[model samples]
Target chain A: MTTQAEHRMPTAALPADASGLLPAAEPIRFLDDDGGPAPGDAHGRYQRPATELLRQAYRAMVVGRRFDSQATALTKQGRLAVYPSSRGQEAGEIGAVLALRDTDWLFPTYRDTMALVSRGIDPVEALTLLRGSWHCGYDPTTTRTAPQCTPLATHAPHAVGLAYAARRRGEDTVALALVGDGGTSEGDFHEALNFAAVFHVPVVFLVQNNGYAISVPLSRQTAAPSLAHKGVGYGVRGERVDGNDPVAVLAVLGDAVESARAGGGPVLVEAHTYRVEPHTNADDDTRYRDHDEVEMWKRRDPIARLEAHLRTAGELTDDDVSAAREAAEAFADDVRTRLGEEATGDPADLFAHVYAEPTAQLREQARWLAEELAHEHGAGEAR
Target chain B: MTLTMGKALNAALRDALREDDSVVVFGEDVGPLGGVFRVTDGLTAEFGEERCFDTPLAESGIVGLALGMAMNGFRPVVEMQFDAFAYPAFEQLASHVAKMRNRTRGAVGLPMVIRVPYAGGIGGVEHHSDSSEAYYAHTPGLKVVTPATVADAYSLLREAIADPDPVVFMEAKKLYWSKDETGLPVRTAPFGTAEVRRAGSDATLLAYGPTLPVALQAAEAAAGDGRQLEVIDLRTLVPFDDETVAASVRRTGRCVVVAEASGFASVSAEIAARVQERCFHSLWAPVLRVTGWDIPYPPPVLEKYHLPGVDRVLDTVDRLQWDDAPDSRFLSGAAT
Candidate 1:
């Protein structure tokens, strides 16, 4: 009963942005890779991020990289089960967090420890899932952040639902979901976009196009013009930015988040970046990638680019850089000392928290486990 | 007031939505159309769009939306529309909804319900009929409940929505039109307890959801043969009522599990094993099972042969050891 034209009819109005469906001709850049100011005409699509925010982002990137390395070392020491380092992509990671207010919600992926750290969450709690102590360490409601989701793109719809609920409650809350390039290929990604667009909820889908999903290249992920272009079909405004450029990432993401907050509907921003490290500690970069490719991305490091620009503009002094590095080393040292100690958890905790009120079966099983532990240790105590 | 099980379920949802401002219902065709089965009929008219609405026909998105809304302080009751169609949302249900509370160390509890119209016997074609309760029951951290009677349908649904955990509430499609004289807001025994629909002394007939009616009918037919069959309706599949079922099986010394699903590694199979394990010395014979054949759901014309009927249940009940067994049966290892 439906015709092709009727099926093709646009579901909602075009996004309120002037650029409409297509993104900027080039990835929006406010700073060149060498840390010099980009050509003014090249970044006319968005304004440069503020100096204060840029300085903050730069220091956070420094601390974030140190945290990343510390967690990687903990993995080798068996303190953590595994760690996914966001080393080269710190700009997009920190920029996404810096763009949002504490009242807003953030949905992070397993590779987004830097974003959580930038959100002011304790570094220890942020690494809990990777530490193997619990599935999620921090309370999501208290932190206004969801657990770091491991399944790719599955949290996209959750962001949409939460954002929609906030709107229905008459609150000006926006949800920003951090996703990888490979996540764009998932069905949840498209479904979440469509739902957000249809409801016109406040949400920002930030896709950090970090070149690869594990060893699979982006070429195999999609053949579209760009990950951002895929948003056009869902009537969401699409924007692309140089993820390595801190100024561009913050500027574009800030615009997208604020625009969604003002009810301009959801916006999908694609950050063109690269992952310098392997997927995780267990993965071998040499198997599917070249050392030369890793070396090339290392040259375009996000931290070095932003630090150079800030120093030239006199926004960061020599003393400020030293203070930043010193703070980072102290933070890493604290983390190392704390991680060296073994984690202690009660065995009974396994039966706890499965339900709000434990079922009879759970109670019986818990009792059985308690008795087993008692007999095994010859202790008279029963939990 | 006389009520059909379907209408009772509708009344329960209406009452729950009225009592809780945080409660919202949404799914494909749930709004405006009032659901294809009409169980959700007239909800949108009473609650307005924010409370009851339609969604894109993606099952995963529907359930995923419930997870998010629940996280943000909303009790979302989502409909899977059918039994087999819910497979698309299994990842969301199993990975997030079922595990969110435990995953967060009890920081998050999803007070949501996934309504699935399940089981065979209305002569419906494939995909429309499936007994998928075992999948949810096997997954930890989810409460799986199904209602057979009109009163139980209203009571259990209200309980499921109020519980601070995710529940997979399966509605037996075949029993939807069956009627009783129960009024709105009727209360029944809470979940995790089985109800004895018929009490007897010879053997126990254990069933749930769609198979409860078949078991009761078989009991009535067995009465004509001087067999007193005790029928137990296991309303809640998970957190199963081990005490009630074991007590009845111990008294009767025999149990036959009746279900519309295939018997292999199923909810019925689980009940049979548990009853035997708990009451091994008291059991007069090995537990028997009457269930659908192990195959994909068949066309409407062939479903009658594949589904368990009263005759099949009675035949399985006949296999239970009795004092009247022939002498030759002892030589065949068929006697206790």
Candidate 2:
């Protein structure tokens, strides 16, 4: 429960280079790339939670990376129809999701399986969607996490709507909606931002500026210098953070979440990161981006950076690191086994949850399908 | 009652607002000005600005906010101003408002009604005069209702407001000023029931919204020609009044469905399918649909050619007439 006064600054007095984007050689860093503390850096702003909290964030990211990698492999193996890997943008997902309370809602795009993991959604459930067996993997109300939306930026308005609802109900909940840099090109993004700002809705627009939108560079996405600056036009407070630094992301997101929960309205956070992997299983990034550029982003690996910081801080050891990796592998294996072993969903399941009270037409269709399936597979085969 | 369909709707909304403090009406220009159509005239004065309010110009925001209010335990009835204006709110309607209950496993019920003034007859341009009910009916979670008569305009609105799920209440803009005899009790019409405007044995003319009157007129003209056509007005599109439709089609053995929506995948298509499936043996002719052309709704002057009219209905009836061809399957009681 941080007060607005503690976080507020006079609009005119704030430093123009607070974000450390350009003209300033001094980059914003608390823990350097080698994981050692940068003396006199904004360490106060980087408020560390319990050791377990940091460990949980690291563990989630590791597992998310594994799930992302394996799912891509599955797609290549034809077990999955498609997979959108959040390979390079793990910190953006993990940091923001880690800051969210269970009561808060998450509106994620298709590539945000990492955020879904942090929200307590089982990886298998997300895989079920990529496998094309289910439309939505989990009920949103039960988990406070909406199903991944494929239509770019459409879910933005929904998140705003939900946050408006929460605000009206006087709930201390916030909605964090994840979108790619490319989604900023959509009118829905602007509409959602404008609506959220005007309504004073408690929503966080987390834009993972991964530099490319399915091969389209960020330069082509918008004419604006930075996505965060777009928020100023809508009268929302905006911040840009290094997406590779999980600590900085966590700090900035925690501040945004607190501000939103305290009735300060919505904020736009642009996590400047790069996508290390191709857009999806179907894409080949070699055509659009050079190997040198990929290598440069790879050096700023969110996981490697965070691991280095933790090791230098004496919060993690080699055995602990080995155990975390082992655990992530085990989790991925478990998910793979569950997905591979699980039976294909019954077609009747489609009609089952359409409505709590099934319509007469739906019932008829379900019955017809059941009878048809039974006929095809012999008696009593359809459920 | 000498009231326009719009007046009836406003009266119905006013009554609902008077009856419950939880009932709130919101849309663009719904307050102060009482809407562009003046359907909601004098409501702001009657209920005050809090209960009857104007929302921002954003259609999706209006619907989305109404959904939030509904989830927060308020009954919100939103107006789309016109049929075409609802497209901006389609995502909210399709993704959230309609599916909220099912998505949340019934933990929440979106008790909101979106009033869309649809259909053609008025000299509205293309976007304003579109019949978009088929789009809504195609969506699974929404209950779509279109009122043809003034009494229906009053009663069906009350029913839509009280329904647990989100309901799309489409009013034929052309019928907004059209009045009907009043004195019917304002009660909840069951969701899946069709009202028989006129019952006959020769052929069943199925219609709804503005086309209902055309069907009734067509039935009357056919009656003079020795063909007693049954006229059935389908009130609800989703959870369709299959019983009423099937009963009429079973007796008449011939059916012609009319709607202002495009001919392809119109509500008439659904009626045609139900009739073919349920009364397959009773059918003597293929269920013909008299609907708007597949092209975009024509300009007002050319709308007569696009929209189904009494002449079109009569032409369809003549095409199916047994007297025109004594060996016609329509009279021979043979399935085509």
Candidate 3:
């Protein structure tokens, strides 16, 4: 019998059906605009989850979008240093993150706050990094999520090593590291892929194809037809999914995660999507990207498509949709309040964690700071 | 009594593996062929493949996997085949191995050792002959150590394996076969201490790695005359043996720092600053440095001019003498 891994690999390239014309095919969508399954659904490996899980996924996507928008506003208002908005790609993050078991580890890049939130990270904690309160907002061991590595694709090898460790320890947990298309060009990405393939480690490299690395477009990044196909050279399974369709992403990722947990080695999942906003608050995409292309992707907004599908399916009423929006707004407000109320970190915290037991030199430095602070306080009291 | 640096390292690895079951040796070509330098010769045969095994060609993978093993309570000794090859693994070194203990708030400890054979003496091309100690020294959590003698070769390797933090043990590639006729030490040496090779009154010569021999040769040349020169070998760079360095410079009143790395912002530069700060009252002259030029290591034919040598060391000493300043003609000639 053919296994799930066999079914996941792309069977055929894009086809031309008509004799007279090659129509601009609607980019692959698992759920149509009317909340019905799309035509020629080929992923036979995964079964749809219960209706509750689907609703939860929808809620998560909404919350992720709300958090992304709030974070962008904070950056614009000068409260946050910078923010990488996940406004257009929430379905891709929510779908894949919701599919994984809590025991599995996540290695996310700077653009993966949506995935972190879907995996139960507090939105305030996630924004703490953007607010510049701490380099890493939360303890990774406590969250089972590594700090968002900003250096393009450097975290891939780290995730592969973690997966290798889990397999060695006989743990069923797998590791999923998320990176952008531009990261695929880095040597660490190739090293990670080669290592995962050679060792048969349970890792799923989730590449969010956002089309540009700052000003450099995907065309300049590689000649490969798609990032997913690059995995073929390493003897691992690769697939492209409708990143805007939560159901499709969930189905593909669920199968991949289960296959990995069962010792089926690694899979490379390329989420074909577009970055609706600039790379970050610091970037201005209007300079590089044609306005027409951005308008074209706006029609494929993940939130709009998913909301339309849910309303048509009678699974979510108009009132229910409005309630979801209101709940997300409230949650974002709560995050804003918490961010303002939390105590600022001490400057001495910089020297606190350089070593397990601070060395003599570090100790001396810490003492000097303490004395400096004490003298300042004394002067203030005397005045 | 005669032992090459490679043989000393081999003996040290064998002894560590025999003494502790926690010790495991790994790297590319380290198992069947006993490593590219043969520093791991006879290890696979003696300790079995499980304890001494070959890994894939990926250096980052080697270090990351060793880190995982270290987290699981294994004392892994990983070797990078060459100095340039270690860059691919620097992320793992700088990110996880060095910072994991602090990142986890002391819940985790990485007792791993990364052995890199570094520096140019033999005719190694550009990538093969870099002095990357400064890179490791710049990283906060990792300890950096280099050995220049057979005793240090035998003792420091064992000590690095036993240290609580990750240690970058840089072995000079050129000295792998340099033989020491003197006997090896009977006991293992402690980490974070400097070894004083000679006692002198005028000046101290501080060096490590392959340059330690150069400093000793310079000391011997100076001693041939009435001038006495002290020679110090800093076995460890981080948690640097500042006490020994300070005491030596205080007694000698002058110092000439030396290393194979380029002069600008080198470990030698740091040593000079620290010595000046701690021993300022006793110092008669500013600490001078006889170091590699601030350029990429030159081609083999021009390497003698790039690397600090006996002549350069003597020239620096001649500049430091207070009495020699009166002879304007001789001083001017030397200066020109």
Candidate-wise lDDT, in order? 0.89, 0.80, 0.80
Tens-place lDDT per residue, model 3, B88-125, is 89988988788877655565678889999999988887
lDDT for each residue of candidate 2 in B25-95, tens digit (9 for 90 to 100): 88888888999998789988987766787755788777766775675557889899999989998988888
Residue B242 shift from truth in candidate 1, angstroms: 0.8
Stronger candidate by TM-score (1 vs 3): 1
Per-prediction TM-score, chain A only? 0.94, 0.87, 0.88
Error of 1 at B224 (Å): 1.0
lDDT of 2 by residue, A1-383 (tens): 11222222112232244343221123235555555565685444446556676777788788888878888877766778788889988888898888899998888888988778767788777666788777666767778887687778777877776776555545677989898899988877888887777667789989999999998998898887678878877777777777887877787788888889888878888888988899888999999999999998888888888888887778888998888789889977886777665437767776765655678888989999988877988755554
What is the per-residue lDDT of model 1 for residues B258-278, given as tens digits with 9 covering 90 to 100? Answer: 989988999889988998899
Q: Which candidate leads the pack in TM-score?
A: 1
lDDT of 1: 0.89
Report the CAPRI category for model 3. acceptable
Question: Which candidate wins on lDDT?
Answer: 1
Per-residue lDDT of candidate 1, residues A178-235 (tens digit): 9999999998998899888887878999999999999899999999999999888888
